[model samples]
Target: MSSLGGQPILILKEGSQRTRGRDAQSGNIAAAKAVASAVRTTLGPKGMDKMLVDTIGDVVITNDGVTILKEMDIEHPAAKMMVEIAKTQDDEVGDGTTSAVVIAGELLKRAEDLLDQDVHPTVIAHGYRIAADKAQDILNEIAIDIKPDDIEMLKKLAETAMTGKGAEAAKEKLTELVVKAVTMVADADGTVDTEYVKVEKRVGGSIEDSEIVEGMIIDKERVHPAMPRIVKDAKILLLNAAVEFKKTEVDAEISITSPDQLQMFLDEEERMIRGIVDKIVASGANVLFCQKGIDDIAQHYLAKAGILAVRRVKKSDMEKLARATGAAIVSSIDAIAPEELGKAGTVEEKKVSGEEMIFVTECENPKAVSIIIRGGTEHVVDELDRAIEDALRVVSVAVEDKKFVAGGGAPEIELSLRLREYAATVGGRAQLAIEAFANALEIIPRTLAENAGLDPIDMLVALRASHEKGGANAKYMGLDVFNAASGDMLKAGVVEPLRVKTQAVSSAAEAAIMILRIDDVIAASKSSAPAPGAEDMGDMGGMGGMPPM
Candidate 1:
């Protein structure tokens, strides 16, 4: 209150909080760095796995960056942005999630130092943008051309993706499986889709037991025990019609006045069921897969006709079956024709792990395939599934892009060198940010070295010097995580899809720049209900309504 203008004004709410300027920038940077550090150790060949137990006590064990970040329960807003970077990387390229997040964290760390020097956040962000673009150029220059027929290179790409995870022990076998799966699903246009390669996991067997099926495997059992267990030279029918009697949408009751009338009704029902069965048999289909339910009466008739039938098949499985078996799904039994039936060499019901499942196998050049993953335990099976998924995705991406780069941190070190040289041409305050970005790119090779129990500084220095002397071919010079020394990654048969590295760098830079731009943080108070005894509480007088104080 002023002496002459004796009045007071209250603007903000009582419980609101606001942080501005440097305090806000530092808080955001710290939270983002914390998130990055959380996933830091889970990178490269010697990286460790994380065993995350959810609130309900379900456990997940893997070193996959996206999986670990997704399992983490983050509350800080800036930290959540860091998690989004991993998500974006996973969605776009399916690998290098840890590299992206770690680079972003290191970028923020460098920006903090620049901030201390009175450089504006915008300038730092601008320099990062420039560095990221230039890094992509350097990557493109160093990337080697790979074709879909490059079987050896693709296998190395797959192996590089699975090196650190649970599948590392079986990398040799899994690498072949992944490459085969991708090659089988690739179209003539060189477009490879990972979806056509289905992965199914079951326990009680070793990882070596995992193999890709030339055909699809339906998890459902045969509809009737009386049906044939196996049908060789099978002519399969895919139907969407329900074999059971249709229920009337409007309720109606018919009073049967006499036994004759009731007998006639039952006879008509039997005749209708028999007619439907006869229609299917006339189509010359020895096997039936239905998307809807099959009545017991229908099953009995099908069994009598020497046809194998499975009911309640999933729609996705039905589509896959159609692709694998060369079949057309018919809507009505009356429309079933000989040409509509799908051909399979053998349709059989086999018991696996004490559960009955149907395998539709041996189609000529089938487009859809399956990989049945077997493991000795549930956890092992789950982790193996994740590892194989990463491998398949990486291989598919490699084929789709038809390009690859040397792995083991070769591309990162080379990009760092090129970026620093480019930064000199950009000489300004932004140059400082560009150099910072160059340093951030080195974290990948550095992390690889650190995880391998080597001196990161010495390794990085050696790697840089190698690139400086070796020139263009030095793109293959990177950390040798296994031997704790620098080696030629290309000669070691370690490589990755170029898209993974490019996407990681761009996405990391975007996330760091976004987080650095936030200068004010205003948080509204959470709304809470008043206590039971204080429901009638109201604003008290300024002085407790005293006349004088």
Candidate 2:
């Protein structure tokens, strides 16, 4: 609002609220820090799990960072941005979400101190840019080369990912299976897709009961009781079209004046249904997976023909079967061919947990596979599923990138040490920002030590001393959380994909810089709009002044 010649000029609407300058910066930073703190303890091999209950009283228990953050109800804009970084980190590298969020929070915390010292937010942002770039370089420099054939190394990476997730009961078995699943589906050029590896869970047995299948498992049973439950040397057919006779989509009436006329119509319908069953028999497909329903008559004929069929299969399951059995989906029954039919060693229907499920197993060199995850309870199964997924994602990432860095806070310490040296040479007000960035990196090691029930200062001092030894091996030295001592991570088999660290640092810095650059926040109220002609009601003094002007 402004005044000229004793008259007021109102600009904004009546209910808008605005905060500018230092107040806005502090509020945003504080909100972001709260988000980070919420997921802070869910870090490292000794990290604790979080049981988050929602408004409806549904409980989620896990140590995964992205899961915890996503389940929260966030309203503040800046806090939502913090959640976004965790999502980005999870989407890109599939791990290190907690590390990314925690680092971002610490950066803001340090920058808040600098702001109190009267340093400009722009200067802090600029210093963070320089520091983030240097940190990425340091990460790549300290990383060691890996290869797709590094099976032992890949398993180690998977093990490191699942250590704290309560899947330790079968971590070793799951690690081996995770690596095998990834490598089996991985292309020769190093592309790995999780879509090809499905995780199916059930509550009945121990997690150790989980096993990998060589092909897809459909959650469906045979459409006919008269059909054979098992077919060996199965030639499978995938159909998208319905086996039922086509009916008029619009309303119509059929007039029958004589019994002979009705008999003729019934015969023709019988012939049409028989013709559809004949097509399947002609194709030599003993096993059928249909995307649409099969008529009752067609099922009877199919059963007589010694064919096992499942009707109304989902389209997604159809695509997976196509990949698993090397079958081409036939859109029309007339287009079916023997060569287009997929081959499986055996197709069988078996009852599991009181429900019938079909298993298509033993395809020669199958491209798609399934892992049946079994647990004694629902919550255990859920946790195991999460752990296996994280392990699978990390192993695949390592295979594609063929590079790894030491875990257990090794890279963070190395970056903290190296960045401090770089900051000294870049001496200025911006130097303070670079130093702040370095301190933020320490949060990882510090948190790891604290979670492990060790004195953070003592462990950090020992960790820095180990890195200060000034050798190639010194760079790989890190805190060993299990042993509660400093050790070389390379020999300890604590390792992670290089992309995880690089992506975390880069994203955390971007979020920090974005939050720092904001000096104003304007929130408009959720009130209804004014009348259509209200803008022109200028200087109408009282309630009785203007009438539809």
Candidate 3:
């Protein structure tokens, strides 16, 4: 309160909390760095996994960075911003969530040093921007082109993505499935659509039992037990229309004057059902997949006609079946025709873990496919699903971009070197920021080394010296966490899509810059407790609805 005019000035709410200037910066940086440290150890091929148990005691064990951060239950706003960087990385590139967060943490760590030296945040942000741009250019320059049909390279990419997870034990088999799935979904225009590749997991068998189906797998069972368990040379019909008698959209009143009238009404309904069945039969469809409910009478007719039918299929599964079987989804039974039927080698209901599942397989040159994942337990299968999901996305990225870079922290070291050289030309306090940015990039390799139980300083020094050797082959050298030695990632069969590197760097830098610019944090206190004396008149402390026990 100011006493100048014997008056009081109240600007902010009494309970509102505020922190500004250097305090705000340091608090935010500390929060961001703390978040980074949480995921830092889960960064490489030998990275350890985190077992997160939720409020319900449900456990999640995985080393995937995004999964770890997502399960942390973070509450601090600045820490949540760091989580956003991981999410953005995951969404954009499907890999490198750890690298992005680690870089963001290191950037903020460096920025704190610069802040202490009185270098303006704006200047540091500008220098980081330059460093980020140069890093992307260096990434592109270092990336090698891969043929979309290069199965070997694609296998390496998929294996690299799956190595540290539960799927590593069977990555060779899983890689083949990934490649096949990707290849099947790649259109003639070279665009890969991952949606067409479905992953279905069931816990029982080993991971090696996982295989790619040439067509889609509908999780539903056959509608009728009398229906054939298997159909060969199946002519599949994809139907969106309901097989039962649909109710009238508008409200209606029906009065049956006699019992015979009710019988006649049911007879009419039966005739309509028979008519629909006749249309499907005439269309040469031996198998039926319905998106809507199928009446019992319809199933009987279909089974009698030697046709297999599965009902209550999901809309997504219906779409995938169409792509896999080359069938067109027909809405009306009257429009059914021979040309509308899709062909498949077999439509069979097989018991998987005692639960029946419909497998539509052997579609010639199918545009869509499914990967059936089998594991000894639910957790293993779930982790494998996550691993393969990453592989699928990264493989698609490589196919779409037709470019990949070596993994194992090689690119970070190479970029750090190039960025430092570029920093020299831009002389000023900004140069120090650039140098800090360059130093920040090394965290990837250093963390990789530390997580593998190796000396980070020695590994980084050896890595930098190897890069300084300057050759096409040496450029591919990176810290091999598996052996705790520097090796050629390219020859070691460790590769990643180029987009992962570029997107990780850009997103981390962007997030760091955004966090650096904040000068104040004003948090309004939560609403005050309910007004006093608002309790009900009938207040009984667990005795009864009476005043006393």
Every candidate's lDDT: 0.89, 0.91, 0.92
Give lDDT tens digits, candidate 1, residues 1-549: 124466665455667778999999999999999988888898998898899999999999889899998998888899999889899988887888999999999999999999999999999999999999888888888888998988988899999988888887788999998898889878899887777888888887799888888888889998888889999999999999987666678998889999999999888887888888898999899999999998888889999999999999988888888888889999887789999989989999987777788898888777788898888989899888888888888998989888899999999998888888899999989999999999888999988888888899999999998999975568799888888778899999989999999999999999999999999988777778776766564544366775432
Q: How close is candidate 2 to the true structure, as a TM-score?
A: 0.94
Cα misplacement distance, residue 75 of candidate 3 (Å): 0.9
- Please give, for residues 139-220, the per-residue lDDT of candidate 2 as tens digits: 9898889989989999999999998998998988999888888888888789998878888888897888888888888898
Error of 2 at 170 (Å): 0.9
Candidates sorted on lDDT, descending: 3, 2, 1
Structural RMSD, model 1: 3.7
State the displacement of the C-alpha of residue 63, model 3, in Å, after optimal TM-score superposition: 0.5
Instruction: Pull out the clashing pairs in model 3.
Output: none
Once all C-alphas are superposed, what RMSD does model 2 give against the true structure? Answer: 3.8
Best by TM-score: 3
lDDT, residue 541, candidate 3: 52
Off by over 4 Å in 2: 249-254, 527-549
Candidate 1: count the clashes. 0
Evaluated at residue 438, the lDDT of candidate 1 is 92
* Tens-place lDDT digits, model 3, residues 1-549: 235587787667778788999999999999999999999988888888899999999999898999999999998899999999989988877888999999999999999999999999999999999999999999999999999999999999999999888787887899999998998899998899898999999999898899888998888899999999999999999999988876889999989999999999999999989989998899889999999889999999999999899888999999999999999999987788999989999999999878889999989879989999999988898889889988999999999999999999999999999999999999988899999999999999999998889999999999999999998788799988878889999999999999999999999999999999999999887777654664553455566555552
Name the runs in model 1 displaced over 4 angstroms: 1-14, 529-549
